[model samples]
Target: MENRAVLAAVLMAALLILYQVFFIPATAPPPPARAPEGVSKPVPPQEKTAPPPPAVLPAAKVLPRLPERTVSVDTPLYHAIVGSEGGRLLGWTLHYRGEKVLAERGQMGLSGLILERSGVGGQPVEFSITGGPVVLDGKAGEGTLVMTGEDAYGVRVRETATFRADQYAVDLSVRLENGRRVRQTLTVALPWIAPVKPGTDGAQWPSELVWQVDGTVHREPFDKATVAEETPGDWAGLDSLYYLTALIPKRPPTSPGLSLAVGKVGEDRVEVGLRGAVTLAAGEVWEARAQLYAGPKEYRQLRAHGLEGAINFGGFPLPRKYGGLPMEWLGVPVLLVMNFFYRFIGNYGVAIILLTVVTKVLFYPLTVKSMTSMKKMQTIQPQANALRAKHKSDPQRAQRETLELYRREGVNPLGGCLPMVIQVPIFYALYIALSVSVELQNAGFICFGRAPGWFPFVGGTDLWICDLAAPDPLYVLPILMGVTMFVQQKMQPTMGDPNQAKMMLIMPFVFTFMFLKLPSGLVLYWTVSNALQILQQRLMNRKPARVAGRGAKDVARV
Candidate 1:
């Protein structure tokens, strides 16, 4: 029964395959068409469209240059004037520093520097700025003047001068905007143009260029404004001996191409800038911002702005490990003491005298030792002269013999000098401190008010000896200093060669000449020191001072 069912299933499968092959077609039959020839075809016309007109930028603008004008800036500390030309920092009258602006017009009364960019493609170098009559009115008011200018290519520049109330500093920023169609490389410069008087004029603040680069400070006279080569500096500006004008970068420039270029422009002008290729694409901005300090170099105030190094207390030659002659370190305390005394005495000049007295008193013992040693040398001078004559043909032998004679006579050749040598640093420090002390600016020991037109070196409203920071107009202090030095030299034992006495005499005249233009404060100190030494010499001569050896008693007191 199973074999029969399988046979029937096979037959049914065969029949199903036969039916499918017979009924269905392998491919679809062609459809019946109504029109199958070119007679029924139709062609459409072609059309070409032109592109939208190419974009054309407007020609670079040529704006009318406006007349330059001065904008007034008033703060608690100073009154400043900023000009529309290059947005230059024209001048500022210092109110707190107690100094009147005596400079003639266009003669950098103070800080005519820090704004100008390198121009290209016949672009005018100076920006024709247009802004406002800036008013920084009250004590707390942020005195800000933002002046803007643009060139023919639409390259705009902005200069901003901001003042903080009751401070001796002004914040300045220069920003460049590239509105050109092509990329632009901008070079910004802030230069000072002033007719600087040659040589040391005591009344004039000496002109110089100062810059800080790579943790080092550099200085150059006005004649040598720029460095030997371009360098990347943190700040650069022209500085007077006491007043400082700096353009300090607000931050380290990320671009390596930017460097500071400083150099004299023409015969009278010197300038500095954050100079380099500050490349800007079209519509991009490049900014060179800095803090401007235009005031007396007060230690504390300058330190506040990280400009204490600008004070320029003369550097002493020494290895890096041992700061040679701690001038600033010692000078600072010296200043502090002077100021401390000033607080009580209300007179810096009197404070200087007191400081001299204190120094003399402190070193009285050393002075006595020096005097006694000199006295001993004088007692043995005749024998020393005989020995020198005997050994005249042999110079080295003469020196040895002189030394042996000194040893036998209990005389120290360096004794008189060593004591004074020990005090040299103090004197030098005092000089440095006084030379740069702004507190002494317009400070007077004796005031005769304004001098007559006949006053030498200074005329017409010339303050006569009214400012200790300046040279004595009448030259009285210098002459007095010379006389005191002469008297002091005379009191010292004349034990050396006869030529030595002549040299000593010549020194007083030389010093007088040198001090003739030196600041009166330093001259006053030296004069007072000489006077004190002479007084000490007279007193010690009567006391029969002993030497440092066994026969000290036998050494006759001068």
Candidate 2:
């Protein structure tokens, strides 16, 4: 019996590993080869020994410098800033989450729309105010903000940003006019940036440069290569696990389309940007249009813009395969239900508990039958042992006779395992859901200060858990869960060799150690579940007559 349970667990683990290895696309490419430290490239030989009169430097490209002022725009969803210096998005804040989505704590606040001419030391095309501040009411469809300026090459650049009140998308239009009577090729870029702080909450989410090229999602980590693999589509930007700042073109760009650039900001953070370049002819006003979406990676919100692919649902988002046994099949439904529960309870901890209860209820009948079968096996153990000893010389005969005895008593050898085996998918699906759902970020179940006044040791202090998404700081939940699991295991009618029983006993501790670092929310779910099973088993044990068979059959020898 112990071997059967162990085999079931092993099979489930193998399937999950295979699914991840074979199905989940590689979001992070191989790290590029590193340059040898302390070994500089060999200097090329010069034709003449005399350093030819200081190699001429390329001409500096500049734009008219306007007095730096932050233009503030407020919407129901987010607050944004446009710097007059470069007409760049300086700051962006999501109101509900109180998180800054734009660049902070670094130079080069070229956070949104900026243009660069093709020359050495080329400055970004900074715009001057072409009109008064544009305002959009929440009831309105669109609010337009326009700024116009000229580059050092005398090329007129007009930038227009149409902000919407109902959604996170901003319609961006950039027009380059070659008013200088000379054609110019300028690199147009929509920069999306967030400071990288390794090994923090910020590091928990993957931050990478992602773009679609011919329908394939190509992602490059910010700390990876500097030069990007020039993807063709104008859809490119940076994203973290929970939020996405992307530039999606209304139409694909001409030749020399989407290119990526990665840079380091001081010693602490890295910057990633996607640039789209287009050539403008003399007396032409070439407009490059794209929609900028910078906000939380809510599935429904992003799905509306055909950017649903950005929401990594912790598994393949394709239609159900393996006859709907895929993790996504269960995970998505569980997540949606949990979200619905949160709407009423307003607490994720409560929602998770409700979900656990719902799962337990759904499997209640199967679990009861499994427990009854285990109890029957426990009752027949002595006779089974006697038969094993009597027929020790005939192994096949002993197995056949044992199966006959079990059938005569109406017992199922595999009954204890089959029910649990069926639940592996649902368990894993819930686990994955809890791991990656952004709604659980910073959600709290129990905090010391929030505890009741009479609660011992944990009341009026920060000693207990503060965030359900993080591990239990005091390790209390994991230890309790381990203890409950062990108790449940002990209460079960486990019929096995002594060594096997000892191994089964140790499984609880092994699981406890494995779950120590998992999110407290998940641990809480497991703990509650284990406690419920123990209670259910105890109740079932008191009703032994319910599963009792005829006395003669129950006493039959194998």
Candidate 3:
């Protein structure tokens, strides 16, 4: 019981630390006066400026007359809109696990390509399409949208966006023909911006710019007055909780002109994107070919495209340079197994339950060893108390006798503690996976959408618990989790100081309060895990071995 309490305390303290690091609400800075939509030039991180100014469009010296009509492209994986005047992407909606992440943000244009010149004045080329609203039926012959236009300033531009009915990626190519007599350098910006959704406080909003620089991923929150960074990378974009919009250059720019910018577009609105530069000489036709991905941030899908770096599984509060260490190493395997189970079970909640069962089965041997060691220690509690009483006059003698007693009984004092410690990484891995996996967002185990008769008041999933990604509205899971934890603690063999045992009893309540507002899926994982531990403990401790002829004898073999 002492070892059990120690293990519980250590686990709880670690969990609280992790929770504070990952989930504590980020304090939003005082709202700045709304800034205009544009790219803010990159600034040195150490410098401070008074009333940091808004960003400017790298591609446009003056804002062009954007078209009123928006062209829509519908595909199986995503839906996108493009404006006619600038041929800019106006909106992108991601569909995954039967949930729409960006559809409700009305007219939220996500990712689009652009062109800019440093000395050239006047709005960048305003593209006019000859034909539009391409509808692709991902078949033997896929559909495509081609928009072509030319500027009077000796530059002609053509943008062709091809879509397939079944894939999330949009094959895009921007061809620029420089008809000038001298060489010209143009800044190409692919802005991937989405309107911040309503009803979400600044703390809950995960709006951010994420990118990979030299094989390392960097994530920056867009809540500040201005944020701009230049890096050397071929891929960059922005993301929310479930959706991602990224641009990958088929050919990297000549110079490391990759920069990220985020600025306010209107009241309660933010726009973000990446900018790069390309130089064109007289009569030189330059074509920038790239792939655009706008869809859910599913691990498998992102991994297939080498964008797995996008999925962040939170780990120890170490600096990101440490790579989140053991958690990242373990999280991927756990997530893969969960995804595999989900394929067969067809529900994330059920998958999590199966995951817990499998983990228990895998660790059965260690658990049995730990429990057996603790039970042996409990069996010798009377002798241990007598020794302490006998040695009341000699503190050193009592400690020596205790060590001798353990050795004579052939019980390893560290056995009970080591096994529990070994199990920490596995549980931590599952915690990180459940919290970050896109597959769990809006997933339901016993959803009312599938079975309305089961849930009346909260018609989402499992009676009162509807969305697994969100908290349990009625707090039933958290309470049950606390109860199971208490039961598991009670099942451990009692051989600890009274004060420490009392502390163990209060831990469950502390955990219950702490988990009140966490994701239901996470709480469900804990509750199921605790119940399994209880069942395992009961089975292991059912028939205690009896002492006979100076040796322990088992009545039945486990």
lDDT of all predictions = 0.68, 0.68, 0.68
Kindly report the root-mean-square deviation of model 1 from the true structure over all alpha carbons.
Answer: 17.5
lDDT of 3 by residue, 1-558 (tens): 999999999999999979976998634233334222222122233224255333232232233566456778776676677776556665555556553545333345543455665555334456666555667655533566777766655667888777777667777777776666555566766665555453452222337767776677777666552434445564676676766777665543443434545555565565655555655545556555667777777888787667778777765645456655636678898889999999898888999899888998999999988988888877776666777878899989998988887787787889888999988878877888888877777787665443454567645445555578888777889999999999999888885699889999999999999999999999998999899888888887776744322432221210
Pairs that clash in candidate 3? 38-55, 39-55, 39-56, 40-55, 59-116, 90-109, 448-460
Taking all chains together, the TM-score of candidate 2 against the true structure is 0.73
- Mind giving the per-residue lDDT tens digits that candidate 2 earns over 87-193? 67776667544454444324323464566654443455666655445555666666777877776666677888888888888887767666654445667666655
- For model 2, what is the error of residue 309's alpha carbon versus the real structure, in angstroms, after optimal superposition? 3.8
* RMSD, candidate 2, Å: 20.0
Deviation in angstroms for 397 in model 3?
A: 2.0
